[model samples]
Target: MTRLSRWLGTAGALALAGLATPALAAGTQAGTTITNTVTVNYQVGGVAQNAQTASDTFTVDRKINVTVAEVGNATIVVSPGQSQAVLTYSVTNLSNATLDFALTTAQQTGGAGAHSNTDNFDTTNAKIYVDTNGNGVWDAGDTLVTYLDELAADGTKTVFVLSDIPLGRATNDVAVVTLTATGREGGGAGAMGAALVQTAGANTSAMDTVFADGAGATDAARDAAFSARDDYTVSAAALTVTKVSKIISDPVNGTTNPKMIPGATVEYCITVANAAGGAAANNVALTDVLPTTTTYLSSFGILMNGTVTGAACNADGAAGGTFASGAVSGTLASVAAGAARTMLFRVTIN
Candidate 1:
């Protein structure tokens, strides 16, 4: 037998002897060692053939080499105007062996700013999850948050929790998230055993563990390398309206006093400018909305020229013009970005 096998057999014999000892409760140190060996046998048909083989054996002593290193104190802060608080925590592996951990929260009690134990905060239900499945999408079934596979020696990982409570609730709505690390020295299979060892590799390396470690393993370090949530408040300022000035020009100036005569046509020009800091588009209809003193006339034709070119205006000796009912309808196109246009109207009043 190999030296490892002999050691294991001896240890097993001692364990049986220890059970019969009366001093077992006195804390007598028991040394244990284990050995593993592989054997292979092969045979060929036709002629009877037999083979026996044994591989080398290796031994291991059972001992615990555990080291715990904390990345730093975690913190969760909320912007003043926001209703949710974001929590960020970090844990580091100081042991030579890898570590697997799970983080869970417990409410604070019997403190100045203590809060009642309630399920108000759920990390899984939050808008931002760790994307555990690597599918680039978040799903309802993937709600279990805060998990770490293998954190190598000198490595670290960060966990995030989003809370629904507002920031101003209790000044310090404190809670504790326990980070339970489990594994064996030199990167053993841990509690997950050999199956996980084959699938995730012998090393205790996980996706988030590598990500946080590469980002420097500290909460502050990771946060500095990325962007955190931001809060904002939006509101309207003010609204106002102001009137500027109006312009009027008579196109039909005549030598006769009270220039317009009955049955005579005249043209009037009206120009309105927008003098405000902002711009506005207006399609103001130029309806006479005539007074009772004025009489309705014939078709009020428009003149595109600089001078009057129509007989639609009244030759009656009057200062203003008149038009038939529903005499004009046209679009003003569009007002220039910051300019003005003049509209001309021709009519006759009796």
Candidate 2:
């Protein structure tokens, strides 16, 4: 080492040592006092000097805080014995430094009849994920992680809590799910004994230790709370379908208890019914093809209506829809609860 470089290094160390005392060796903590004084140890052509020390102390501050808020109050309208509800939350790091947080969710712990009631139904397949698509909505494709990693102070992340509601839940049954976040290791909340935040392998030097106030009342580790909730409702419906047949005329059976004879005209009735219990069935449609050994009449393809009775052709295709070859397919009006529909088509025995 050069002679000048060695002398300068020694002088700088001596200067810092001149100001060093008990407080310099003391630990940093929350709500504490700190005092500092600078003393110069140097020579200008071998001259001496000294500086005054301040005995007045400054108060240390513990502002490791965060705020958690539900993106919005979410209430899913669903069918009984139904589906999943995904709720969004915003977790913001309000601290001055970076922090890592562990996330967790709990069912309603509130007393009876509370909005957080989970008695009616609890969630299934519960999970949490991050929003990577930049959209506020949780897309099917998004990054899934267990913790909120390295959030900068004043920064926020969009997170989703996804869960499925069990079937068999009664109508108007509501279940609330709550989400909570706590401090984790690698930063402010490392393992016990020391608050040193390890960057790579593990804690090594004293410089890695974290202080609530950065020195002297106590090095207490703290967690932040940002919680939110959402609920779901269910409703159910029952639908039934029936098919019947009638023989119009048979060259052999003579139209009474007609047998499957060639040239015999057959009428097939397809009916659908929905019991009066829930909302109407939507986008209802029926599709079918003529069975083997039978030929669908090119002209009389399908008869669409809500009513049909015994073997009589008493009712024509009043509501019969446009025919489309041997294959029958078309949309029908939504069937309301307690309502029924019937469609008939004629086919000749091959």
Candidate 3:
């Protein structure tokens, strides 16, 4: 008996009994070959005829999708002069196939950031890195990558943007950074994949590229890219230092409102004040170099953490500082916000 066979160019009905459908998290993988075959059993003139079969086969198209979201809900707290400050984000591949993603960053200028704060400053030396250890924080083991390599479908990766805060940034200053990931082809090992081009005209026998990514902070819909924004907020100490000097006595005029004459005892007061709503200043070192004509008193008269009395530092402080190499130096443990600490010492005119 002869059998009839035919090829189906398009989708057709198939006859399969009790076929089991596999459960998939990301649906059928891209580049998967799906084929359907139908078998026909019939009788011609009361005689059994050979079974006929027709089959249709096609490859699954590539659906490019990704999501980029900031890891935390709050803005990253940073301080002036801080180095290697990190802003974390997670990039998840929602595509049906493994892919490489090209990562890029942008600095928002004078606009509201993701946290609704006005962006005022730009962080310096910004760079992108992948969290190689699956940890959200950036570490020495993390690789500095310009793009993610061969991330599987439904896989999530932590990415970090490290930057340097300038030394003179003010408190409450915000720097907004945007991260964008564009989907690319994946096949090469240890290297970035080529840029993806969406299939324009018609479906082919091979897998076609379809962009299914949603709109993000900086990208448009169906662009095969996603973006997210995160900000760095400065929580720094605003310190102010003020120095005042007063004469205590002279060689001729005793302690009765003495004048600034030769051989006069003069007192110096140094105040360090931190602004309100700012971070505390710690380990403040106050130093004063004595002039060539003036001489530092030999006794332990240098007072640290003194009390401020009417625009002048009083001598009711601990005498724990040192005077050497023609300089008077002391350390203030801390100066809290809206608070001040003073260092007072006395010297004599030559």
Give lDDT tens digits, candidate 2, residues 1-350. 24444455555554674677333222234344444333435656777656422232344443455556677654666665444467788877665456676777777643332244444667687788888786888888777767787776567888888777776665466766666755443544332122323233544332232333221111123433455565554544456878777888888878777876899888777776777866566667787776778888656667775564543333444455545565666555777777776777788899
**TM-scores for every candidate against the unseen true structure:** 0.26, 0.51, 0.86
lDDT string for model 3 (133-248, tens) is 87667899899999999999999999999999999988899999999999889558778888899999989999999998889998899999999999999998999899998888
Off by over 4 Å in 3: 1-25, 37-55, 249-263, 309-312
Clashing pairs in 2: 28-215, 28-216, 29-215, 29-216, 68-226, 79-235, 80-235, 81-167
Q: Rank by lDDT, descending?
A: 3, 2, 1
Better of 1 and 3 by lDDT: 3
Please report, in order, the local distance difference test score of every candidate based on alpha carbons: 0.35, 0.60, 0.87
Best by TM-score: 3
Tens digit per residue, CA lDDT, model 1, 1-350: 45555555556655775687654221222122223333434567755456443333222211112222222332443332343344444444543334454433433222222122222222222332333444434344334444355655455555444445433332223332322333322234333222112122342222211122222211232211222221111111111222121112223543344344554444555433433333343453444444343333335444211221232222232232334564432334334333444445554544
Error of 1 at 294 (Å): 42
Query: By TM-score, highest first, what's the ranking?
Result: 3, 2, 1
Candidate No. with top lDDT: 3
